[model samples]
Target chain A: MISSLKIVEAAENSGIDQNIILKFILNEWVVPLNKKELTLDEEDIERIKLIRELGEEFGVNDEAIPIILHLIDQLNHLHLSFKNNYCH
Target chain B: MKNPYKILGVKETASLDEIKKAYRTLAKKHHPDLNPSNKTNEAKFKEISHAYDQIGTNEARTKFDQGEPGEENSKQQWSSFYNTQQNAGRYANSYADQFGDDEFFENLFHGAHQKRRAQNQDINYLMDLTLEEAVLGVEKVITLANGKNLKVKIPPGITSGTKLRFAGHGLTENSGPPGNAYIMINVLPKAGYIVQGHDIETELPISFMEALLGAEIEVPTLYGSVNLQIPPNVSTGSKLRIKGKGIITNTDVGSQIVKIKVVLPKKSDPELLKAIKSWNGKYDYNPRGEK
Candidate 1:
């Protein structure tokens, strides 16, 4: 299926700082495909759109969202490795 | 949005048997008749019906199961939760903020912080899910009282108590950076599966003879049941591991752990008794090992 653009457009529509948009990509919460190409996938567009919306709706004032996200990543990796080593 | 697996409360990866099973179970509980007090349940019943309609057919479940969420005009959005209580007045939902009379939001997000804000504050929405749904992932549409609709894209590999966000669709206008809706999903536990640190542990009862002589027993996992080999002379409480048969997380994968509970016969026949008596006299076996 073609990638959607709703996500990126949400950011554009909201006029949010482009930095948050860049941060989302850096964090891998959102992925970009074919950087060489000008076209954005539907998923990329839509996800950005939603991220833009989530910010406005909740007013999540914490700049720590990225930190929390990193924590989530660390916790998941740790949990997986722990399970790998554990028996029964 | 029309994933039938969502209606039957099954996953895209669910087998036909699994889907049927889920449908029966949900139908029994959420069928408007069984549930009366909850209008939410009634609405859920409709949703299930709609989902089933899309998935019950072999042709449809196949399409939806393989397709990514949000096709055909469904939009998704999320605004990362920022730490700014003082600024809440500026970004609060205009409709919701109407009740509070907060002048802060009226002008701030609408006018003042235009250059700085990327999106609005993420909205918080609570979604109640079953353990199965949490493990397998599901698609749902959260409809607000105001008729605004959000068809959620629940990605595969989420766990119980996992939170998902939909960006910039909550009470904010489509004009400014729309805020995200944070869906804090609570998974209702089910019978049989035991969730531990990334492992789904369960006790599979095996016959004494099987445990003593080693046998192949079926064990359940998130993927399904696989025949597990129990070594002969295996004692009760022995654990069997199926590599890569554990939990699947959003960020990574885990394994399943099965504990074998050896079951003994409560009563024995006369021949068995005689044989046991002779064996007991000869071997003098004690389970506690003369502690």
Candidate 2:
């Protein structure tokens, strides 16, 4: 479980607002975490990090991020098509 | 792991407003979007994003104040990181040395940079593959039109129009970072086996005798040979779907489809011809009419 403080830390680390983090959670952008004391999971954290990077790299508005995030989630659920390292 | 304040080059006691101002300033400065073909500056941009992300918020600031590890935030920072290598070779540009390596790191250590990556252009290319190579997962030495040889590992289960990204391997890395080389998979049609999605389609010719009497025929697949059971009284054209016997998916599941054709002999034996003629001048049989 990712501690609440760490969630805040993650926000600070990415230089994004807490609202953005909360928005990710509200939109189900990241993986579902154990609902214990409002803690996010490791996978969720990684996804959030990637989202932040995309926003930074693409100059994408945080509001527009959900589209890509949704697309990625859809693709992941459908199944990975890219064959790279660690792919069987 | 350093202090977020120091990373973004902001003061520890800086107000939230000041922190935000500092963040935007640094983001606009060292940002991969703004930096021109400099990996070092790109790295610094990451650091700036990392720092701002850590200390820019109240919760994160409080956590940093209390000495708690903001692992999620670190990961979040990474998300914002660009593979400058794939961003049109910006990371590979020789101009990064304008500020010198030491000066670049010093500025990052000081939290002064901007977002320049998104402005840097990216490149993409289409790649072609053979059915045999795609099925067997061959090692492809692809030579681009511009005369660059790239060794690519062709994975099994790849479909036509699939795209692959090779980091730092495009035509040019103009400014921010080297862009990725995109390999758009074009699987050429095979001679006998027709590919459709994850399933393989094939047509096999069976003699009328074999179709009427029912027979087991050997059909060639990518993996090898499999015996197909032809049902008795099978029609001229029939399609059979084989479950889990087709091409491999990226996840390694198999699927297949088979089409069969019943062929008749061009010439018949005298006895057989006589027998057919006796039945032919015409038997009142219309399988398609009012049946």
Each model's backbone clash number = 66, 56
Evaluated with lDDT, which candidate comes out highest?
Answer: 2
What are the per-candidate TM-scores when only chain A is compared? Answer: 0.43, 0.58
In order, the candidates keep a fraction of the true contacts of: 0.05, 0.05
Residue range B1-291, candidate 1, lDDT tens digits = 334655576777777778777777787788777767543455456656656655776787666556633352133222222211012211222223233233443553467453655554566778887766666556789985347888775544455455665555655654567676777877777788787865777888888788778988777776677988888977767877776555553222456778888888887678878987888889867878867
Error of 2 at B284 (Å): 8.0
**DockQ, all models:** 0.04, 0.05
Query: In model 2, what lDDT does residue B271 have?
Result: 90
At residue A87, candidate 2 shows an lDDT of 48
Candidate 1 lDDT for residue A57: 43
- Write the residue-wise lDDT of candidate 2 on B94-174 in tens digits: 233444444554565689887766333445666677786776566778885458898886655556776676666754545
